[model samples]
Target chain A: MHFTSEPRLADGVLEREFTLGEIPGILWTPESASASAPVPLVLLGHPPLGLHKMYPRLVARAQRAAADGFAAATIELPGSGERPRSATADQARADLRRAREAGEPVDEEIVDRLVLPLVDKSVPEWQDALDALLSLPEIEGPVGYSGGVISIGIRLAVVEPRISAAVLFAGTVVPRALFEEARQVTIPLHVLLQWDDEANDRQAALALFDAFGSKEKTLHANMGGHTGVPQFAGDAAARFLARHLK
Target chain B: MHFTSEPRLADGVLEREFTLGEIPGILWTPESASASAPVPLVLLGHPPLGLHKMYPRLVARAQRAAADGFAAATIELPGSGERPRSATADQARADLRRAREAGEPVDEEIVDRLVLPLVDKSVPEWQDALDALLSLPEIEGPVGYSGGVISIGIRLAVVEPRISAAVLFAGTVVPRALFEEARQVTIPLHVLLQWDDEANDRQAALALFDAFGSKEKTLHANMGGHTGVPQFAGDAAARFLARHLK
Candidate 1:
């Protein structure tokens, strides 16, 4: 990993941007953390709109995690942020446009094309990020994952034993294979669903939640649109993460 | 609707080929069917491989319906049978090949492009065919739908009140929107699922089944690949159609 900027101190938190191989990411650690007494880590799943678009939420969530004595981080998902556009991404954009214009549901295939590569590329990058973050004296195990780009969260929760718990956002589409894989997830999960999300398939979201084999899974459904998550819901999710990580 | 050939008589059954506007179709009527004593009608959802490829299944299904004293019919789905190939179909084929080669799920966009137009075109066409068939004194209401291309089945179940019952094959993918629309369906439904279908998304199929609003729906899951549905399952589905249509 290559640090792109000097660490900045603010509000008792240390913040820095870095590139882990080809993946861009941001890391936030509470200033009070030390090698002898490490804090649990939380990896945030960046929404498809990229980190810049979601900066405020990312910062807020990370800050909340820091406030709760945990380190938080987020990586740029493939096809988002500063990554160069590829043919597949272009096709996915066109497909989205056509589906929207037609008032049709986005094709599952289009969704698979858009998300699977990100899951394939991002999961390993996240594992690497976890490795680097955990190597720091101030960041410890008993990790938690939070946010959208849900396929990544599902993959990480399944494959990365370090992610002890997950708070999954349901605004994104879940591929069928992911649903199959979800049955293998045995960790605690806190899934947030905006019940009236205009851009989401509510049934698919419910189905994915049902597919999780985790014995400790909770569905926090709120009445709103895709971004209409209430503040309390976030707090509740953070509390769940805190309970598991701590 | 224009009949392209004379109705042929065989084993107490009558068969003929016809065209509805630009679409080609086939109709079968039991000899016992007459103006004074009309028989219930069944519209078959021809599979994607075209009527020629599905001819045996269609004939057998129609024959079973006929023996059960119902008129049965099927039209070539758009992009299937002898329909001229288009750029969209070619792109979808290429996309499917790429997805399969990569051991990835085919993007929902490719599926939408490949199947949605067919769904759009076929539903109204099937409605029209229903109109023409019902107009014949030998065919009557309390209709049944059998087989698939599942999107068409979901649409027909939702839009056409003439269809009182359906036997839906779960071998195809269900688009997210269809799951929402499925909630409006109230007809008695018998869904056939090949539990281990190699190409089918089992979770999606289950989700779709769960989304059906029909209070009288039954899921008949068999163990096998897409075509592994056994003879007994078909007979059971026919029995279901018989129970509702007769």
Candidate 2:
């Protein structure tokens, strides 16, 4: 891992930009974090939107996590942001867009093509990032994964031993294989679903929530379309991660 | 209304037993509540399990409400507690138990017979208690209705204009009529569902949640059986009430 810049937010959160191999990412740590007193970490996940476009929301979440005494970080997905795009992934996106424009249901095959490969490639990159992040003296384990591309969160929860908990947003087209993988996840989960989300199927979201094998899973379905999650819901999600990670 | 007792809980909350006409009830207020600075009220609802049976759970909820600077109260359901029982209601309960023992789905008519009359008789009693309770010097308006006998909560949320918010437990046999009434409830709501509740219908609960008209509604589904709602859920409900009631 190599650092490109280290800029502090106005509230004194240290925001560092770095790269692990070809993947670029950013990390935010609270001002209080130090070698003698390490903070728990939360990996912020989002839809395959580019990092520059997602920075505002990511930074806001990072700030909230920092306020709750946890460090937050996120890396670019394989086909997103400045990273080189896969031809197949781009073709899948085009198919998804055409389906939406034609007012047709998204094909399951299209969803699998678009998301499965992303999950296959990104989950390992996240673990690699985790390995480097934990090697730092100022960030500690009992890690948490929050936000979406929930398939990745589900994959990580099933495979990654370091993640103690997760706050998953039920907003994506979950590949069918990931639904099967969800049954292997045992960490505590806090899932957020937008009840009237036009971009996703509500029953599918509920089904994914039910497939989880965790003994302590919570689904918070709030009244809103996609992108309309209320403020209190976010607070509740923060509390959930804090309860498990801390 | 008559106050039969005014003992203080260990935390200094004033617990008063009262009766309106012949319906018995209890009211709990924080020590900080007074005529000069009264607190908002939450009308605690429960199954027709009698006050004697529900006292422990009710008082714990009341104490927590008092701790959050709100007065809490509850009135016995029509055929519950030390109150006189109805033969028709008794028959319905018998049928319900017989079906459960027979491993058959509870008939909707049995549900209606078992719950509708209770709702019809209980809602007005709650309203009357609300009137008399609000007339007290230590209690104020901007009320909240919380806990179960969910059909009653649905009715109260629809009819009672004083209730500014509600935290309804989706753990009852909701009458079909109330599902329609749910769409008329525009107040902010927080509905809790025990996802694996042995005695409740999960799909019915989800359908009812979808029917609620509250634009600011939230559905919190947690892993547990009927009586296994995790402690964090209670805290989350308290926070929801505090957000709207205060």
Best by lDDT: 2
The fraction of reference interface contacts (C-alpha pairs within 8 A across chains A and B) present in each candidate is 0.00, 1.00
Query: Candidate 2's residue-wise lDDT over A1-246, tens digit each?
Result: 898886766696889999999999999999999999999999999888899999999999999999999999999999889999899999999999999999999999999999999999999999999999999999998899999799999999999999999999999899999999999999999999999898889999999999999999999999889999999999999999989888
Query: How well does model 1 score by local distance difference test?
Result: 0.84
Model 2, residue A2: C-alpha shift (Å): 1.3
* Candidate 2 DockQ, CA atoms: 0.97
Query: What TM-score against the true fold does each predicted structure earn?
Result: 0.51, 0.98
Residue-wise C-alpha lDDT for candidate 1, range B1-246, written one tens digit per residue: 899999998878899999988888899999999999999998988677888999888888889989999889999877777986567867876887789889997788887776677788789989999998888878888899998888899899899988999988888766677788889988888788776787788778877877788866666655568987767567767878888887
Which residue pairs show backbone clashes in model 2? none
Q: Residue B101 of candidate 2: its Cα lDDT?
A: 93
lDDT scores for all predictions? Answer: 0.84, 0.93
lDDT of 2 by residue, B1-246 (tens): 899886656697989898888988899999888999999999999888899999999999999999999999998888887889999999999999999999999999999999899889888889999999999998898899999789999999999999999999999788899999999999999999999998899999999999999889999999999999899999999999999988
**Model 2 misplaced stretches (Cα beyond 4 Å):** none
